[model samples]
Target: MRSQPWRPQRYATTAVGFLAALLAFILLDAPMVQRLEAPTLDWRFQLRGPIAPGPDVVLILIDEPSLEALGGWPPSRFDLARAVERLAAAEARLIVFDLLFATSSNSDEEGRADAALAAAIAEAGNVTLGYAFTFGPEMLTRLEDSNRPPDGTALQRYRRSPQAISPLPHANGTLLPPRSFSGAAASLGHMSVLLAPDGALRSEATVVAFEGTLYPSLTLQAARQFHRLPRSELTADVGQSISLGDRRLAVDSRMRLPVNFYGPAGSFPSYSLFALLNGAVPEAALRDKAVIVGSTAAAAVPVFVTPYDPALPSVAYTATVLDNLLLGRSLVRPEWLRGLDILAAGLGAALAYGAARRLHPLAVPLALLVPGTLWTALAYLAFVQWHYWLALAVPLSLMALAAGFGALMRSQAEQRRREAVARERQNLSRYFSPAVAERLAAKSEPYSLTGTQSATVVFIDIVGFTGICEALPSERTIELLRGFHSRVERAVFGHGGTLDKYLGDGALAVFGVPDPLPGEAACALAAAAELQTSIAAWSDELVAEGLPRLKTAIGIHHGPVIVGDIGGESRFEFTVLGDSVNVASRLEGLTRQLQVSIIASETTIQRAREQAGTAGGNIPLGFHRHGDVTLRGRETPLSVWVWRPAEESRVATRRAAV
Candidate 1:
């Protein structure tokens, strides 16, 4: 088999895979960089006041129309007075404004409006206005020091939001801060923002860091407002709980919270400014419902960009934050998840390597895909159910590792195939003859013949076989047989012969069994002559050892014979079967009767004569004809020959030596 250039190596494969994983890891940010993308959480005094110490909450927005109808910028302070009057009329347990009035009024009309507002404030002792603190600590501290609680009033349970103290920036966009303001209203809380990981509103954020201090986000604030729950009543571990005198309200324990954005979207609660001011909503609805006021005006504002407000109207943002708390559908990524991310990545990589190590190359894809699916599911659960952001880097890296390792192994396999082929080619020539080796190398597999068919056969038997065996001991006979067989085998091989078997004093050989060589008759005769000469030359050694000399008679014939492996279940021999083989054996028996050491068919005699004449210097060979003969089990006659050395050739060749 030929080797391919693209082979996979186990070690190199591992290396390439790890390298790919590392590259991907670096590109995907092995260490995350955090960015904040929350929108503005600012609201007017009307929405911020009366938000705390109360039932679970939902923030209804009172937007731009209210501004237009009541007159803009410090809308008839008297109108805000009317808003309070309305709250008092509704018998609301708490009234928190979403508005702020920072500067003092001086004009007679404004003064009158202010007096009216103050009068309403005095009347509605339950009202609390929203106030914001600017960036600097000293400025906030000064304001905190100077702000006195009303005569018998208590300080707010929550402090100003540090995040609002200063604006935060992220790579994608800015988390806008409101125009910082501080007001005389009590029960004020910093309306802060929540951020998404990529700075997009695809998911919600609950917890945020502000000015070195973490704060409850917009949804939490809205939740606190809805239930009139003070910060003290809300437990981070058990969600929110509020007890307003006798009644109690509850919210989930796990979040700042996120809204489930049900699509068939655009269902956000939006209130036209005019409708809200004219008491368009039933007083019963307004009485206790938390009103979180913010602009839904189409124009983007410096404070309109809340984290959850991306592409949503600001009113929707308010609703989203509020509803998120009520439904416990907050998208709160776990804060202490650095450990999980690292663990996930490490486990994923290890699993990939393990799979690569243990499984076949084909299994690597399944290894990667299976784990990838698991990770995705885990990520979804963490995001939606558990509100945690799980790192996706790990499992993805594992996938890359498996694939990369597989590719490397594939390349290495090809390399090994090439090497194996080279080794095989190198060793093949040693086992087979040059001709056989060449044939084996030409195609798909080794050239071999386990079964056989028609072939010419030959068998040689010594003249005094039984007598020699009687005179010699078994060991000597064995040694003599070994030596004689060795010699015969050499001659047979020289003529491209296959030795089939050997018994007491003779062996069978075939010229055309394994491969049918042309001139089989000629080659067999030459081999026979060589065998005779070889034995005759060994006479000196026989004399020295005081052993009888050996002489063999060769028989040759051409006829169809089944030449192949022939044996029992356990042992087989590549030999011929049929009348032709039997005839050859019978012919061998007649060599002694014919009184010549070599006998061959007329076919062998003729072909030998022609070959000797054509290819000179073949051997010291000569032949004589033995007339037409019939052998045992033969249906037709065969004209045969008894061939010997040239000097004695006439003895056998002359008619009727018998």
Candidate 2:
């Protein structure tokens, strides 16, 4: 058959849809989302500069020295005044106190302490104080006429704690500013946790939205001081830039970015108040730096404990804002990238399906490895170059799935194709030899061959066929033909021969071509014998059906011949076109001439001789050489042989002279 390897197969629409759907699915269920939510690994990818050089950022611990020097819990009121004096003298730009002054008193001693602190605050106007409010919005469940602080709190304001399913006055939401101590300093910032979806305080804050009003973040307020920017100057420019004071602050407006969490966990500095009050680093060390005074005391801090420092106490979350402000660093993930994540997942799923469908088995590993590695490197590059936390999970996951699907689909398709081709080859064997039929089928087109080679061919015919058909009905003739063909086919196949063609009442079978059998003549003889035995067995069944008994004669020969497909596109047959084939046919007819069964040539006789020698003299067969005789077409005659088993059976075979 002629090779036409470049032709494209008809493409299936269902296949495309399947490929696309599979890819989309892979993108959506990316496996890295769990890791993305982890605080530690996330910090590693997003962390960057402005980390205060380790030594510059100082944590002044309010230790036992401060406590013992000025009693605890509402520390000696006089102590607050003195501390403010010293901190103001130290030249701290923003001295923030993470404590509230909520008590009311007119006693001379308390008044004197308050006056002294108030005086210090008036002088050091850079002081900022910490304040806090209840968790959420405030409202009244039902309207009330008076604004007299209500009987307690509006039920809506209370947020209905679970235990409050029973009767109790709702708690009022407190506005902690004047009463909570922010007014004591020039500026006030909330000490609230900007809880993330993963509940890690890596990113600081955006706008603190509540009750339809947006308040400045702690970082923003401190930044306002650092840059000396007013609320009006806090302009967000085109999402790409922001302006605060003279400084165009390096920040994102939609602030869900990565923060440079410097170390694995507890990298935040801590110091003892005893050393600070005693001027441990000398007063020169405190000058020109922003001083944020908060608690390192166990009961005072809220939630800063980390694995690295388990014994560490919680501090006001506001200290984090202060830390971020003093250093000019920020982690930035643009608003646009989240949408990209969704798209990435979907696209990945489709590619996976295509890769699954398209690649061959051996090529599959390269198909997966190249793209998987490329996507990962692109993700890392995005982090370094753009500060964009483009998600790696969905795309990487999709690539993996595509590779897997490609491998699985390739495996399955190959198996199915092999089975299908095998079945087709077998079904054609009823008419053609398996070797010839396989070559024809694999051509991707019907038979078209040229040239030829040496081959062994066999022919079998039903005996007394004309008389049997004449005696039988048309359907009976068909049944007889079907039964006869079945026996011949089974015999030919059992001995590894091809039934090349079937002419009514007979067939041409071959043992060698497109491939040769190890012992073409011997195998051919076995098939012929099996055919004869089968025909004898069928004779009784035919007689029982009120039909004549059936008999068959087979001819086998091994010799040189020109073998190829013959005839036009409309019809063709793989045939041996030479004198060897003619002699084989003549010899089959000569079964009657010789009054015997199988036949052979000198070549097969010589081959059998060598095979017998190779088998340690065990193969039992012999041939008597006959001198050359002229065949119908040949000027030169060819020698032949007659064969029989060493222990002669009734069957005898004569080789035709060519």
Q: Per-prediction RMSD in angstroms? A: 14.2, 8.4
Error of 2 at 200 (Å): 2.5
Off by over 4 Å in 1: 1-67, 72-76, 91-186, 194-198, 201-219, 228-230, 234-266, 300-310, 335-367, 381-394, 409-658
Q: Identify the leading candidate in terms of lDDT.
A: 2
Give the alpha-carbon lDDT of every model. Answer: 0.54, 0.55
Candidate 2 lDDT, tens digit per residue, 328-353?
Answer: 44444544565565455445544555
Give per-residue lDDT, candidate 2, residue 329: 42
Using TM-score, give the best candidate's number: 2
- Model 1 lDDT at residue 210: 33
Each candidate's TM vs. the true structure? 0.49, 0.71
